[model samples]
Target: MRWPRHVASLLLTAVLLVGPPILLVRLVGWPSIDSPQVALWQWVRDPLTEQNLILLLVGLAWLLWAFVAYFVTAATATRVWAGVRWLRRLPLPTPWQATATGMAGAAALTIATPTAPTPDASHPGTTTTTGTDHDIVEQADTADGVALSGGWLPYEVAEQVTAAAGLVWLRRRRAYRPTRPHRHSQDAQDLAPLPSTVAAIQAATGSRPPPPVSAPAAGLPPIGFPPTGVGLTGPGALDAARGLLITALLATLRQNTVELVITRRAVDILLGPAAPHLRPGAGLRIVDTAAHATALPADARPSLSHGAEGGRRVLILDEPPRSSLANSGATMVVLTAWPHATTWYVEAGGHTRTSDTANAGPRVCVLDTVATTDLLTVTGHLQPPAPDTPTQPQPQPQVRVPRPTAPHHDTIRPDKRVLVRVLGEPALLVDGAALTVRRTAARQALVFLAVHPDGVDSHLMAEALWPGLPGQRLTGRLYTTLSELRTAARTAGLPIIDRTGDRYRLHPDHVDVDLWYFHRAVDRAAAILADPSTAWQAVVDAYAGDLAAGHAWAWLDPHRESTRRHVLYAYAALAAAAPDPRQALAYLQDGIRVDPYNADLHHRAASILTSLGEHIAAADLTDRYTRRLATAGLTAEGALIRGGT
Candidate 1:
């Protein structure tokens, strides 16, 4: 709703709250209240004698306003609250319920990457740490990266997801380089993510800042857990403990900073059935007792690997019996909250209270065991069975860009033609070379025109391209940018941008855009009678990358994702219409290259390979899917299956 409407609603609410009492007071002060029937009857017989016609109309109008106000506030509040996450923090789900919820999150929620390399987070090393070694309690924002507790707000979640997803893409560029100690010290700014990734996050969630969801449960930052000892008890306590352990493991997985001291039984009982697949990645130690899991300086502990950093170890406990502390002063984690021993009490809902309910703190992101599994799976800790795989030991599918017979945007003739390419990096091709416009805004204006084929008014163009600028400045900026674009086109010896009256547009006769061609191909493919292979191939070939990739313009995200959907449709249709199983697998494999986390493509490819009697190859395809996820730290949202899924 607009501000004007909100203002009107506010006024209506005020009148609604105050109006009834005033009306009652006015009735009580009626002149004929103390008189007999004759006086009251006389006034009633000629109501105009007591009050003017205008006053009667005014009173009627007030009644109508009150009626309208009641519906307005009630409807808007309900609509607004429906999207808010605060009230949605669902009471912890049961094992069955949690499994369903957690699996759904695995499919929907994107797993975020940490800010920097931890011991085993990215490249395998030892216990986790982001920067300098600081005690968990000492750092206020320890959970800001992994947010084992989900984001407190919707946008916070978006920021975390987008940032991490961006990093995932960026790391691909550096994947070929060997992991060395010095790589950690390289500048972080060189690898910062673009804004388009943030918009992609919005596209994925259907909201740039999707509504905050009430998480099933969460615990405080594992680092910040009370060192003396803390316990989880009451309803959903075990689930909370499971989530807590998962959070701690994930957080410290980078640096080998945390050691788990528990018995064989505790693993299954605490972490659900997903616990068995846990591979002890670098720095993780699961021992039976504290004495064995004790933390010592690398210098003091000769058993430590040569040159390994020391003294930041954290002990995680879940009542593993059979040993004593023996003067071990390291941080202790106890499963059950206690009065004298447990020190801190945590409920399933993530409300933290000391044993006697005296000390309390705000809740953190929490999850049920099912969700915990889903999260760990996304981070590559737990491996779920391949939903549609025949078996998982076959040849790896090559990640290749399929070459098409039809011309792509890259090879098109630029002889006296202006080509705007928004499918990859925003570029203007003149004579087959890029035209570097003087101003960033100038480049943006060209892209803006490319996306909007029909001419736009200066006001719309100004507001979209430079939203918060004052009218005078917006107008000047728009005029300057347009002039610069025109000059660049002219210098390149082509007439490109055209201005008609108060509107601006690209010249239809001289200009062509890849986006325009993509839409045309998609439209042709949509025709019911069309033999679509040629059109489908055109659609696949046309998509070079995301719309205005590397740029973060808020308006570009929907277009990028929309284009992705179109390409996926083309891939599916093309593969379906292929003559043989091998051809279909090839088509599906190409699609997988573009989007490695697409479950449909992987499933389809696996099924095809299986049908062709290449069971090992099919198994390899499924195995590749899991490894790809582990490489980029993504979990494909596969087909929903619940048979010990």
Candidate 2:
């Protein structure tokens, strides 16, 4: 297939070399040499007579012909041999030579046949072209019609055909060959019971605990390295730590053989089983240990309290008969680990077979006992309020109080709702009233409540408002701010506070918060979709506006955009629910207007247009959508959307 032109070139060279030699030898009528000696052969010569001159010329011609024949034969043989070698393995020519050869061939071809039919006319169905330099049309004349033929193939047509066929075949093959299903089987012999050769069996006729349930043995090797990039320590270590805990559970469930590579401190803690005790007046006391082993020393037993004054609860771990208490168990969990060196955990237990293997250390950090315990203790008992006694009623003084023109009350009840507005650059109307709290601290306090929208306690409020002040001052400042915010809320009618000891939180529903509406809209939308036929109208109603529009909250952008997209989808869904084709098309158009680039919108529009008897519009939209996706560099995926056309 390669060097096809070489066949023609070598043939031409052979013809040129061989033509004269054969003609000369025949014309000269040269006598064949019979002499065996080289000297005699060389001495033999042609007679130089005038008549012989003509014969000499003819002889010369024959000689030349013979030489040409020899050259042509040699060239032909060499070409054939070269081609055979090339067929076995080709050596690509240097780039320059390749380019030059292509140029020469193209030039030669151009000179021989200067132009091809750019405008195909031969076979109209088979000949289609895009960019062309010339045009041609073939026609057959008849009374009824003109039949066209001799159309030229576009340059890229062959390539496109081959690629398309390959792609089609690939897809067909994939469809024909579905994914393999999983199969698992175990032989009876492979499920033989474990050998007890080296185990320390007890001599006494004691009932052995039930053999642990058979488990699927771990099929991984052990290494002193990390697991899946999960470190044993850091900010996200809790998940890994949980995995380690789960590993302990798995060990118990799988009845895996385990080994401990714990630190000395952990060994010390495990050596003694500690129990918590409750005392009469002193509350709870934690005691060191209790010994349940029958083989325990008498002196040790007497000193160790079985039951003391405090409420006693004891934990006992009994060693297996003839088995070291430390190692024999269903779950062999390791507690301690060295800070520097890595340790491994292995599981070996199964119904069909047995093997020993270890995986790299858990991608989790060992718990720091001291630090963890201290943190837990410190966060446990934060007192919210101090005990106070009720004051006696004082009703002796009946001073005349000037009533407001609108008849104001002296005190606002705690349970009543009061509006509290925010005063700012844009001026927010919170709880359906204008904000009166002008101080930054007061505004900030209200902002914190609005930001939390759930509830915030007194401690956090104090932290937010008077973070730099001392504890008592901060507490005092928080009380003043709370009083001001409460008064403002009372004037505006909003639920200002719901107290629990000293903590307070906002009542989200009691006030008209923007977030409340947004969430309500989202929930309403979900409810509508839950039953589309009955709730479609409600879903459309809930999309009031962009979330917190004109508000400077960058964090809400993704949520806002997500809501916008859902709104568009809601429109599409409504389009589907329309009672008539006209209404459906209208809704589909509205959806496209909202989300022009959304493929689903375009698809829905196209489908609606098609149903409404608008073929051109439907086809145009479909084509536009396909082109849009193709321009975005998703041609393969676009082809799929085009139904593999």
The digit string of per-residue lDDT tens for model 2 on 389-408 reads 12211111221111112112
TM-score of 1: 0.40
RMSD of 1: 19.5
Model 1: runs farther than 4 Å from truth? 1-161, 164-416, 455-480, 492-495, 499-503, 528-530, 549-553, 631-633, 638-645
Q: Runs in model 2 with CA error above 4 Å?
A: 1-490, 493-505, 514-531, 589-597, 613-645
Q: Scored by CA lDDT, what does every candidate get? A: 0.54, 0.36
Which 10 consecutive residues of model 1 have the lowest summed lDDT? 176-185
TM-score for every candidate vs. truth?
Answer: 0.40, 0.26
| Per-candidate RMSD, Å | 19.5, 37.9
lDDT of 1: 0.54
- How accurate locally is residue 288 in candidate 2, as Cα lDDT from 0 to 100? 29
lDDT by residue (287-343, candidate 1, tens digit) is: 655445553443343323354343234455665323344224444555554444554
